[model samples]
Target: MVADEKKIFGHPRGLPWLFFIEMWERLAFYTMLNVLLLYAKDFERGGLALPSGQANEIYGFYLAFVYFTPFVGGILADRMLGYRRSVLIGGLVMAGGLIAMSVPGTTFFYSGLVLLVLGNGLFKPNISVMVGNLYAAGDPKRDSGFNIFYMGINIGAFLASFLSSGIRNTYGWLMVFRVAGFGLILGVIILLLGWKVLAHADRQPEKDPNDAGFGAVAGKILMPALVVGVITYVIANKFIPDFAVTPATMGFIIGMIPVIIYFIRLPRTVSDKERPGMFALLPIYVAGGTFFMVLHLNGSAMTQWAADDTARDIAAPAAFQQDALPTYYKNAGEDVPRPAEANLVVVEDPAVVRMFGQKRMDEQTLAQITARYPELELRDFDPKAQATDFSGEEAALFQFATAIYADGKVEVVEEKDAHGVPSYSAKIPEREPALRRVAFMRKTPGGEVFPTYLVTQDSFDEIYSGYEARFGHPPEQLEPGKWLPVINPELFQSLNALFVVAFTPLIVLLFGWISARKNVTTAQKVFYGLCLTTVSLLLMALAGLASDGGAMRVSGWWLVGFYAIITAGELLISPMGLSLVTKLAPKRLVGLAMGGWFLATAFGNKFSGFFGGIQHMMSPVAFFLVLAGLAAAVAVFIRLLLPKLDAAIEGLS
Candidate 1:
């Protein structure tokens, strides 16, 4: 398999082919993932506007299944389709899914998520197995090869942040999905072009009489798991109706029970020599499950932290500065200035204020909306009550009225049909001086004009309360020129990938240097990684404390520090664990073993969602501390198992 011995940076030539293919695939994967939660909960940006808990549940299940499918994909590739064909099939299917997601409809969006989960199952595991195949048995370069391959993943992930931000900012969310689909297409093209170079790494399907057939595994494993999951769902609904966790989550957890039993019984069926290796993987799976449970939070709870609790008021260079979204002021500190009170039109009705959170419509738009819904009620805004010379946080008290409008940028409250598909319609009451709220307009550098509105006190929920508690008076006011650029919350998702790219080389070198002097095993590295993960969560818990359990906004630097620490831990665990799987799994069972690795990841990812779904139930400090304690407990468990894990790969590496 290692023929044509040409090397790319002292590793097999196939490394580069796999590297670039994975790079582009991850770019597409992460580009969609980073914004899924935000888009789900967004109101103004053509998003689903689902509640945070529901969105977190969806995100978690998506991530869990995406990793879960690899188990089936791995078996199919190992026993039927070779790695190369599987990779191509996955790429094409995933591209179609991304394109589907770009289409406007909840049906298309969910259908696309299903496609993504299926595609990732086929794509994710086979490629890594191919990377392992490039090196002969017990080759020292294997670990380093995995390290280099991991960089490709992070490089794509690093770029995804900017690509998602730019495409989402300039075009919209749908366009972001469209662009990601095209990126996957490019990766498939690269794979096609490098087919000959990667040929040596593609092995024929195994023909082992001793191995269990895919059908046997599916019947004994998959079908029973599904039945158990359904039964769990039914029972939970019937009995634990008031359970803190969602029934679906409880079902998923319960379903994994049989799979866990299968894994526990697996070693008994293996040859005596291979039994220890099979047993060793169980602890390794535990370690992986624990680590990913925390690491995957980037898309859920952590993203929520960035969006809601963190201060993102970093000043952009003059060329990039523009009017921020109305939601930005909700958590913005007193340092960020409020628009002049004269700029706001005061609406007495609280219901009207809630309908248009911070929206403004011009006279023509208002006239069109009123004409379309003439049966709607009308309200008159007082003309002489304009408090022109106002300053301070008190100015947020002003609310503007508007008839419903949606010309791409404008938001109108949504309605759902009997079939549960969302359609836009709001009974926006007509107001006097139709253009009152549109008095202030901000123009983008591209010369596009959009109306901006100051946040009403009701809209500035936590910020208003925090200001009132801190300073019995409204804070000092600065005029328009002193404005700060509000960084999009989704862009912060990139920090983890950025830190991975930045830290990989240093980590690789340090690990090499350490191994040269001392016999530090892969198990020890995972143990240390879990310890660091615990520390990172503790750091975030402290930040939650500083913010008074999310009553105040903290600087974005806290997020920066969190990513830096956890990424260092990620490098130690993820790639090393992948390399360890290759070293320890029986040659015939490599694909299944890889699938098993991802199955553990699926469990971890599901729990990540479980925690995220429950996030709003607890204060920030308690939430972060609970995660920190879980990580610490896992680290201790891993520490107890290190000797056995180290022994499993003792001679192989």
Candidate 2:
């Protein structure tokens, strides 16, 4: 009992171990997420290069299933394996999955995903239950303890982004997966170390006579659900193959109907006193799902924005610039060569050279380029000479000579003798022609002038055209003497976690100060969280508008600001939701209720993907405004239920 009664940081001795384990687990999870979208969309960099919609659909299904399996895992933990054993098994399985993901081939990729989903199901819910178990029935410290644990989750997430970026940039994408696997393995070791300390918290509750056993629950709930899901999938595929949403998402939404019914019927079987709380949970579940649908876009739509529409040239340390930047930009082929020392030596208007020298182009420049290169196509041209005789935007239509010979003068070998020697010399043009040229004065150690040319490819025209149409201008041009470091787009994904780490304490203190003045209920905090999330989306909508419907790139600060607001909302909603479930659910049904919470989360995550998949189909402003409206509506709906929810919370503490 003394060992069980041990306290650390004013909570159970096991709390820190659980916190560490969850932290590492999240590190592994988020590391994978940080690179997932990029990996799916990248083509030249040895990635799958799937369409945005397909990639988003896959992301959504994986997220949904990952959360959905916890329902079964929680039930198994409650009735069969105790919490510790379940946690151990889940950790190991998840670690293995992460490792497996590093292996090449589609089979391994899908297999690893399946394992991760299964493992998360077993691990996620039971750990939260154990945290709740650590406290006594009326312990006031429970909320704070969950908050501390939640911080650990963010710490892992925050670290994961940097780690994934560093590893992928330094080594490759495959190594990132290996690192995530190793992180999970470390977490399992820590979990094992605290095995005895965690023992008292592991419980397999005795089932009441009225309770449905595992087999009945499976047959009545899971079996029927699976059948419906399969039917929905088939129907969707046969009749609506081109539906706006993926067939998998449609199937999942349809399958959830029976499970939804089961939860709805649960309150009827409970006593009158417990019924209000159980019934109140349904609305809470809906709100939580709606919130997560918007929040989890970090991996899909938001990530796409980071990759395609955000200016990522953050002033990073020199070491990162040297070591990581090259790897991030690595493609499958050899590096394209550029002239080490070259001047524009413009024969045409100097203004054209100045416009081309810009890091990004403006609308006038783009229109000029389009008009000049009306028939521009990808073609091989001499590396030593310019592709066209003209200057400025006309030059962009052809490939420029990037290679330089030892001598500054152009040599023409007109004829060769038996020994392959030049017989005679021919007249050479005064100025070497190039297709496209950008002048840059390097700031790094070399500090040499290099003229770079755009590679001729179909994507070049497509990208430029899209940019011109969206911003009513060309991409921003670079200044000759000033250079912007190219950053790995994946790095931006870390901002959310970083914001969580930075703002958690301040938000906590703010809430605590408010609660001290007026007893802030969990429901109220959740409502506040919804409002904040709406604000975050609104900020993004404004950013979209500012970007001229995502034709131009926005500043990275927009993402930072959005994440900061939403993280504050996350702190208020996510952990509080967990705590609320523990406080309100019937004692015998805590694990199931926890599963229900995750089930809602699973749906929300799935919808997050669904929305992300459709991002390209709509203008950026429309996309963000739709999400903002949904979150705002959910907030208002929750506000209407506040009185009933407050009544349900009466006497729980």
Candidate 3:
């Protein structure tokens, strides 16, 4: 039946099912990731409100472990479950984790993350292995098949950002999880429906007497990893509290030692022909890891740049306005205000009045809030003083306060004394804060009135400083209730996915055209990919330079350009790496080798986080330059080894 089946896009009958399944899985994954950092740092919008460094640490560790688990999962699938069962189990587990994320509370959140990591381990590598299994040895369609499959992954990623933004904006962060969970469930259903069609690709390796069994691999790899990880953690804690490397990072690096040793010893166990291939894989692994360290910054440093440093005041398109566009905001706290809108209503709060008058503010809370607004002064409640006597800053401390309602309305409240004197009190809104628009009656070059959104006072100050320098005057303020819309930070993240979807087909065609005329080895493609990645960072470095080290926001096109450049590199390197693994790995260890690719990706992701953790300490240009230099170095190294790698890959495909 398999032999009689018609091909879809020059691939097997089962390819579409696997493609859609992967697409849906990535949709769920990217949807969750789109809002992760924002949710962690949000203060007024019911997020964890963690510091950037701490949040990035968690992000990095989560990504690292998620990729790491595939190593074990691949071994298990090879020996016991077979690819199909492992994939099914993984899909279901991931769906459950996504659903669990919708439940409120820190425990559920962390627990959900753990489940996702575990499930992805089982699902990710094995599924890719199945894709390769569908093709016979030396099939010309192999690389193209992976590319088609890769497109599916990007398609899901492309849609997720916009869809997640809409759901999060309309409902809340929790609802985003629910929607993503449903997407995964749909993917699982599709896989089940096509189970028989995909069955041919599911292989349970024939046991070889010389092959390392599951128990042996676990004891030598897993057990040693755990022991080393624990020892590293304790040592890092007791002896190196002030060390440059974090304990989590140190532990992860130490834990990988045994696995590294295992790979090093693997070539010795294989045949002489396989030995060169394995040796060639080592450099490829290093290059892959280094490349991903920059690529995965999309979730950490790049996301931060989108949130804190990009100009987002341009009007959203009508289509996006109806969905994801509406939910976008400048920061995590409040919604961008609408132009000429009166979403903020003044209301009186007696609690604020009494708290201000009685000097009942918690010292810690006062310190924290005041730290954000250093000029704010809290005056002791003077019953005899009239509200009119206080300055705007003093009045803001007690008499005037802002609160956001559940339905996204910002209210300003004023307190009245017994003598009918009005005092100002600021209230922190819970849930969604209504958009605050700042009316800037300035006209554009086209003579249309310019629109502006209310920025955080901090953001506003920075912007105003730059604006004043450029235009010779501060922007005119609008009367109360008037505002301009600000763009949501998460919306910027969609650009990379968008570029991937838009360009993948073109890139594929171009590469095919080139491949037909001239032999372009996978190693050569990866080398070019590294060069493009370096250029992407260099573009960012230029943006930073133009912005004077992030003293002001840069244009959104900077991000667009960066994503476009890097995504081209991604298309070249990432999918090619997967294809290379399937081509190079011995048939018996295909799944395990695929796991090795993901493991390298895991390390790169960890490095991305480590780089992000220190982002606050360095200027933007310096940070970007450092990454560019690393990528450039790797590109050079790959160039030096291209000859040997090309020779090793000869006749393999």
Top candidate on TM-score is 1
Worst 10 residues of 2 by lDDT: 332-341
- Whose lDDT is higher: candidate 1's or candidate 3's? 1
Rank the candidate models, highest lDDT first. Answer: 1, 3, 2
Rank by TM-score, descending? 1, 3, 2
Q: Candidate 3 local accuracy as lDDT?
A: 0.73
Angstrom error of the Cα, residue 564, model 1: value is 1.0
Deviation from native of the Cα of residue 214 in model 1, angstroms: 1.1
Candidate 1 Cα RMSD (Å): 7.8
- State the lDDT of candidate 1 residue by residue for 444-469, as single tens digits: 45654333343345555434455556
Give the alpha carbon lDDT tens digit for every residue of 470-529 in model 2: 446654533432224556676767777787778777877887899889988889989999
Specify the highest-lDDT model's number: 1
lDDT of every model, 2 decimals:
0.76, 0.72, 0.73
Candidate 1 has an lDDT of 0.76
Tell me the RMSD of model 2 versus the true structure.
13.4
Candidate 3 residue lDDT tens string, 66-178: 88899888888888889989999999999899888887656778888999999999999999988888888888888888888898998899899888776664456778888
TM-score of 1: 0.85
